[model samples]
Target: MDRPRRIAGEVWVAVGVLAMAGWTLTEPAHPAGFITWAAAILVALGTAAQAVTGSLRWWGGRLCGGVVGLELVGAVGDRFGAFGRPGSPAVSWGDWSHFQAEAAQLVPWDRLVVPAAVAATVAEVVLGVLLVVGPWQRWTGKATAGLFVIYLLAMIPGMGSASILEYGLPVLIGGALVSSARGDRRATHQSPAVGRENTLAADYK
Candidate 1:
């Protein structure tokens, strides 16, 4: 895609994600949440596909990374009551205690809850940052896929009623593809000599 079209696609995908996030915070269990989530995933899937198959691979990677990063940070914020008061209808897992209660259902051992929650929180922030400001997109993307897979498996006991699958599955697929795809060759392989020449020309001006 050309630069303008590529930018438009990225913005569209970002808006879709933000819409889903907003809807989720206000009405996580609402039936419409599924529709919005699915629609966003569809848009994301198309953009990601175009990126992988065309010259926009770098842009695609950043898009996926940004979405995932924002999701992680936002979820962490929700856990800490950043968006709303704990136990309020406007928020999900409105506080750390509330989040732990939800986590307790997925964790097998009582002893593991605190440690697991702590580890997961720390991982989310670190990985989220790395994904957004990536020096290693490929590895970070794979790690993100792994994290989502773990979450999916943890939800198996409630698979019959799970809402996570609506977004989780697509994210897993997107993360895998982002990990495997190559970045833009021209951007990665630009000559240092050419850059130095540009610097010299600017200096003389």
Candidate 2:
């Protein structure tokens, strides 16, 4: 990315991280809350570093990947009642049964709900790990994007009651991951060619 655009993106990311940090700190005191706040701070620092050095590809992939990975894993935690009871404000589904119930609302077949919920949970965990670890980003990013697209379509039935963040944010982040992956691929393809050209020019000089 160009310097101006890269700086602008970093600024926005930093602002987001700061906002998350602020929110996390304001939440009821809990060990997990502190951890989340710390993570947000780290991301903010990473964003600042990238802004100063203008290293978007390296930092950008990790930033986007880390944020998405945490979101997926944290969601799974919420479903498992890690944060609070199922019906509590902090919890989403709250347990396997609750998740299945929600799945039933979206799944056309009742028999498919259990398996679908299980598969989704497993996929989210695996994808979350892959994204956080930074291996196979191109394929993982593509997969994440596909997953979010599926989520957006599934939520159409409840769009009237759903918050914009519920249906929109994930899709936006997924698109960013896909775009970043493509940028990485292009950079990979051009590097060796650029290197070869530089070597030949030096030989002539």
Candidate 3:
């Protein structure tokens, strides 16, 4: 909630995401799993770089953009892999099988997964674009926070540990996003009270 604290939070979050993704990448799972892991790290790297370079100016926008772009790339991979032949490349980690199970049980899951993936991917792209250009920025941040929360919740009913972590990563990202967007830290940093003691001493002269 303060500038130093905000910086500290961002640093820890960046570290956590990189650490989680790095471990996953080394562990060797499905291609989908690897891609998701890879994407998380990639976004974290890009985000940290951008933050250091001052690309965001504000706190959250650039990081959100980084993840949105990363996930959009992931959406492409997921759509391609999900639509591929069932046995092709051995369909890593049973996601294909889970989709099959969901399809069989729900009848509409097949239809839903594809469409939901499409819509979410499209939304990510749109939000990314909005973030880059200024006017629509606030909406993009809110949308990302909302979607990340939903994804995290959705992971609960049956999403395995990996999937749960996958979703959790973004939820944390969104939390940072919300924190950055509100930017009470930045405001407090600039507030006179923050340095009023020093100012008061000078005034006595």
How far is 107's C-alpha from truth in model 1 (Å)?
A: 0.8
**Residue 179 lDDT (model 1):** 33
| Model 2 per-residue lDDT tens digits across residues 1-205 | 2344344445544544544444446643522334444444444554454444223545654676676677678878978888888777646678877877877877888788889888999999998887777666656756776776676577667443232232233323433343233233233335655744543332112
Q: Provide C-alpha RMSD values for all models, in order.
A: 9.0, 8.1, 9.3
Sort by lDDT, top down from the best: 1, 2, 3
Instruction: Give the TM-score of each candidate.
Output: 0.66, 0.62, 0.50
Error of 3 at 16 (Å): 4.6
The parts of candidate 1 lying over 4 Å away from their true place are: 1-29, 32-46, 49-54, 87-90, 158-161, 166-169, 179-205
lDDT (CA) for every model shown? 0.59, 0.56, 0.47
Worst 10 residues of 2 by lDDT: 160-169
**What's the true lDDT of residue 28 in model 3?**
56
Best by TM-score: 1
- Which numbered prediction scores highest in lDDT against the true structure? 1
TM-score of candidate 1 relative to the true fold? 0.66
Scored by Cα lDDT, where does model 2 land?
A: 0.56
